[model samples]
Target chain A: MSAEVVPLPARAPSLGPILSLTQTSMNAVNQIILDRMQSEIPLIPALAGHLIAGGGKRMRPMLTLAGAAVCGYQGTRHHRLAAAVEFIHTSTLLHDDVVDGSETRRGQSTANIVFGNPAAVLVGDFLFARAFELMVEDGSLRVLKILSSASAIIAQGEVDQLVAQRRIETSEDRYLHIIGSKTAALFAAASRIAAVVAETGDAEEQALDDYGRNLGIAFQLVDDAIDYDSTAAEMGKDKGDDFREGKMTLPVILAYARGSDEERQFWRDAIAGFRTEDEDLAHAVTLIRRHDAIDATRERARHFAERACDALSIFPESKARAAMIDAARFAVSRGY
Target chain B: MSAEVVPLPARAPSLGPILSLTQTSMNAVNQIILDRMQSEIPLIPALAGHLIAGGGKRMRPMLTLAGAAVCGYQGTRHHRLAAAVEFIHTSTLLHDDVVDGSETRRGQSTANIVFGNPAAVLVGDFLFARAFELMVEDGSLRVLKILSSASAIIAQGEVDQLVAQRRIETSEDRYLHIIGSKTAALFAAASRIAAVVAETGDAEEQALDDYGRNLGIAFQLVDDAIDYDSTAAEMGKDKGDDFREGKMTLPVILAYARGSDEERQFWRDAIAGFRTEDEDLAHAVTLIRRHDAIDATRERARHFAERACDALSIFPESKARAAMIDAARFAVSRGY
Candidate 1:
């Protein structure tokens, strides 16, 4: 995943205001994360900490914290909930890195690379279990139902992605559905559970769910864009890593749809052929740029970002509300 | 895992009575398993079904069902909980196959082998989430707490086993701890939660927990012994697979502790060095036999079996209670 959204110089700032707004709650979340990640087996904490501490803006948990804050929640339970959200996200990352055979994450070697696939897979399971444990402690069936269902959907999304891997015929709709479950389900649950915790009514819960769902889609669209447009350093991944893996991101889908017939063959040869040329990545980038796929993807991200902001319109204006809007913007703009 | 216990022709039957007694509840649990395992992604259930459908004795869920019956529960909540218990067991099997690099389970191709590691791991996560979902639907915080915590402990046990993989110094106490958390904890939780659902008091809960815990440990010990003594057909895995994987099962531990210096070197070279001599498995089996590790392991299993039966002493002599006592005896005696 692209770690953060890169804002244009003209924008006030991305994630900064949101981070500071949720700082106290975020600190508690971090503490819970540290305490919960540890096990009698050192490898769990070691593998988990490597990814969690490598730290790409803890945006999901931030959404949860901000959601609770925006709803005028005064209790400390959101901290535990936020930490649980982060654990779910981190667990997925560990498994994703293994599935993707990724070597780098957050500009460092991936956990699967440092530890083994077995360790990564088992530790991921441990973290997921710990997330549920936290939710159980929170003592709300609704919250548990939401998060657990999100986890199931997330797994489905990952499997769907696996099925779609290297297939040139993968459609934009399919791509959105995959991301909707894989990425946005957790995001939606993270935001929606905050309202549940705050005992806010269904309307507020639905609003926050929409906000997080749209924000997550926007975040992923920009992440897809960053994969093609940014260098290895900016993406915290090898350049054209998506192209290498034959992952059907939006830019690829858009370019494949809009490109000349010859360009379609190039994508097929480069990705689905199972023998990526050394120039395949660079060639893929050129075609993506030539068709303005990156720009189109970013525009779609902007659309979702707007929707995310609109979802929060029901809440009264406050620092939390304003920061949440910036977070939506940040989701689209992070360091691209 | 030892897929099933094959009974000797001369001995009293194992698992048969328990299965017959809980036939109705088992059928309900089985139906739920089929229903809940279904998913839109198809791969989730497909991979899960590949393992779940591979057909082992559904012993864990059987414990949950029998636990409820022994308590004279009339409600259907135990069916859901029993399904949850099976899901937890099935989820671990998926992950465990990947971790063990196992090629066969219950005498069939392992899910990881058939579906690939990525599918195996993600599907495992999906099943686990479904388990939590079932517990949430049951709408009891106590049930949720027990199962989730068991999950965490199981993960820890797997990691601890990973740590002990090739370490000859791995103690019996440490090994027992690993099995306690990884295997018996779930059994304990499964049985105790039945009491929770039945609204049985703490005394009954504790009794059932002890019964299940001891039975689980006893089950695992027999499983370990079976790995050494049983044919590939009997064990449903390659003979000496644990030794091949460098797993510190009880027989290996006993043999290593009791062996000659030459035998120790052989184990070190074969296991820790990660090179299998052509006859390594044969040599290992011979050494295990020479040390009487199989009988010794069976003896220990019998000890746990007695404890399991003793824990059920509080309950009156009913068919359910009698069947449960036989299960403990069956746990140690099947094909030994």
Candidate 2:
């Protein structure tokens, strides 16, 4: 927990525009984040600080801030709410490192590695509780309801993913459902909360939620594809991490569905058998490319990005609206 | 996640009196629990069900139910709140087992051992979400605030415990604070929330919280003492679990303080060094008895029990009131 978070690779240029657009609210959100993360226990702030410093781009929180700006929210409540969103996200990252036994995340040693699993798990719970505290202080039962349910759904999605961990036969529908709940639900909540704070009508709220949701799905799809894309090293993770861990991502599922009998057997042997030969990663890559799995996955991302853009059609000509649309493009653009 | 929970030992007798007193609402709370735990992802329910089946006293939830009754409330909202209390307790227990790497609880397999650590951790999170869902449905900002703060404090206490884990130099004040936050905070929240539900005045609410806080401290003190007592097996867990784990409970602190120089060194080696000699437990028990540490610990519990009873004096004479007082007695009665 005492470990300092290593800074990320600059700001990942793709995120710069949207971040620059929402810079004011994002800065406010960051201040609140820094405030809520403090604790008398040095380890808590240390561990939380480590993750915060690891450079998440604060994407979900940025969504909250940006969504509020786009919805014309004038109050300071969104700052606290945005902080809550980041706390929840960071909390899950801590627990996820424990659950996944992951040692590295965001190109830095995960908190579980630096602080130990027990510290990670407990601090994660602390952050979660802090998130609830923030929302409760906000004094909106509706907002509380939205964020709390999203928290539950995100957990359910993680559990669902664990249920699918090594099973090559996990359905594509199940994959979509997992990503939607685990990733997109929070995004939707982040966006919708802005509307709630702004006292906007349901239509506008739903539009923002749709934009966030579709963007979230696209974001995760692009993330999954990047692991298999030729430039995975540029993504700051070792290529074939999902494969070595027997993670049944979209590309692996697609490749399995489209591969020939021998290739299917190869995947079964490599994935189910937990084989991590250097050539195995290469062969898996070869088969995925041959089956055009990465292309198809990115295509799915593009579709969702389009949907995200479509959800913004109701917004007036405004900088906030345009940046959100560009944010969708940024999500899909990372798939190389 | 797919594993069915093994049934618990026929219910422990200690909880019987409180259980009988709060029978009706407890039953209603149970129904809500069963209903809310249902999830399409069978794994969520499966892991959660494992912990639920492990036969906890459900004391915290029962406090919520009973506290509401003692406050002269007749509404059904307490049922959901009580269930939320249970969910929070169960969720922490799930994560606790993983953090402790414990294999058994309640004379049955712990959820982590039965469902796997990842499943236990994720399902624990799901239950937390479900608990929040239950509270949000109740729609009380005060309840949300109380419970959420308690949750955060509990996590802080756990981390403090982890930090204090092999250190014999941990002060008695630190130990009490740790236990107060980790164990008693939820109890206080559970009790205080019932008042919120009943719309009781702040004085009544504070009294109930005091009652629960004192009772909870008493409860944990007795439970810790029982581990080193000869009757630990009757308590359903192995004797010396805490001692082996180097937990700095009250008795241990007292024994360390009162021991001779040689005996103090023994304590240091056995606890700080994680060295468990075959005779160490027996010798420690002998010293604890010679120092009257267990008796002193029980005395402390009794003091708290009396304080708890005093807190309930504001209420009128009634069955609920009597039972509340009796519950305090029961908490301290488990020790020698």
Candidate 3:
């Protein structure tokens, strides 16, 4: 007997499914965020609210909510933990702006630029401490460990990126390691804690962790790809911030490795901070395009995204699982 | 009954007693510090060690150890917690240098000046995270809440001070409130956690908190006074740093408040950043000394030191209690 072949329906990969899936829980998390970010010091909330109320996607906390939904967690504990996750992310963003001297973020003035670096730095610290307070209130040692370890990893990753800056010889392995620590570590922790709250078994926890971690890698890869992609829309960040800062993201790493001798000289000069003019950025984009490095980076992201989706295979089929799978695919499809 | 007043022994107050009281436990705390501050990132440890290994006196951690001793607690948990206290202090100091743009600290180039501001900021973050991780390992929700709350307060105090900077109208009350948060909050938490680890009752915890809190205020007051004392020995920090930073310390507040019209204008211009030359600093010192602001600040410190010692009266008399009392007295007596 001949086997019948089936064709699946095609649809655009969008964040709609996951966002809607977790919307109610997200509102609760947002409420927790607003309540906890408040301090007697007015500037704390004012400066934090500038970015928190700004057009952030709240992507990390969404992972926690969605992870909990996928795990069939009925309790409200994830709400506080998710808020904690968002606070940690926000704290890092504030400090990141200070470190990068970034003037704008999310189509608005960065806290560092608007409030000044000292305020930004101190407020970042306040938010970080607040994040810990939220976790402590949750009263889970496991959650505390997951989040605190991730925080240290994120800080180390930041320092690693700083050390790698202005050096053209940074490899893809090192780049991945940095992003894994700085970005994926938090993502993994945010998702894993959902299982902790749900009392899910070790296998299920690992599944969620793998899902979040791989998705984080995919998300960051696409972000780096978009930085060098000429056809990409404005990312609400300076179009060439990565190049200007001499950051060695995956696109640049691949482009440099695949370049001609003269092109290699250009990459070295650009990454060494010798070429920062607009025209120099344009030329860098051209070189990146010539080697199809953006496409290669996206391809790498696709690999991780597929892994992210496959990680949820251990779970029974449900709308939450399907939405999470779409979220991974959406991460890879971003900046198209 | 004849009440005989026994005059106190005519000996200079010193940190010697407290240092000896906590020496054994402090050694363990130091080991934990050296171990925990390390990371796979070489620069993390290198930059952190630059400040940690620098002669910081480890005063905050000593409070934790001494509080444990005063509580008659026999456990190693306080060792890790004490190290965590020191980490928090180190983290704040590193960020403080960046915020103040300080070039030197503890007789050495600051992490910010040596490794760069970005490194200092990121490394500060690493140590802060590491501090939480240590608390998590100790598995005390109470300690976590104490330290985390204190940390938030400390950050708020820092931002408040930043807002008050260069404002000539800052009152002593406001200055006291700022120092209470920025300096004493951690001290209170550090001492309180020892009671938590010892399972001491609430009364003992409150007493230790009061002791550390008052001592911290006294310590900071002396530090501020020493900055303006012409006869004071070099205290390993730049002598005129607070003046140049326009920090509204108690001495500055007192001097500015008590100045003549022309001297008030000088104070205004100096704080407003118009007067920053060495001679300007010299003139400012002269004005502070002329008003006896240093002595007044030290007198204020003495009040807090008395309260700090009195806070320990609830505990039975022991070497630990006497040493702690001496430590408080020494805090007020510094720079004599």
**Top-DockQ candidate index:** 3
Better of 2 and 3 by DockQ: 3
- Tens-place lDDT per residue, model 2, A106-194, is 77788898999999999999999999999999899999999999999999899888888888888788899999999999999999999
Off by over 4 Å in 3: A1-9, B1-9
- Per TM-score, the best of the predicted structures is 3
The TM-score, computed over Cα atoms with residue i paired to residue i, of candidate 1 is 0.95
Write out the backbone clash pairs for model 3.
none
Top candidate (lDDT): 3
Can you give the TM-score per candidate against the true fold?
Answer: 0.95, 0.95, 0.97
Instruction: Name the lDDT value of residue B105 in candidate 2.
Output: 84
lDDT of 3 by residue, A273-336 (tens): 9999999999999999889999999999999999999999998999999999988998888777
lDDT of 3 at B79: 96
Per-residue lDDT of model 1, residues A117-205, tens digit only: 88898898889899989988888889999999999899999999999999989999999999999999988999999999999899999
Runs in model 2 lying further than 4 Å from the true structure: A1-14, B1-17
Q: Which residue pairs in model 2 clash with each other?
A: none
Rank order by DockQ, top first?
3, 1, 2
Can you tell me which runs of candidate 1 are displaced by over 4 Å? A1-13, A231-233, B1-11, B230-233
Model 3 chain A: ten consecutive residues of lowest lDDT: A5-14
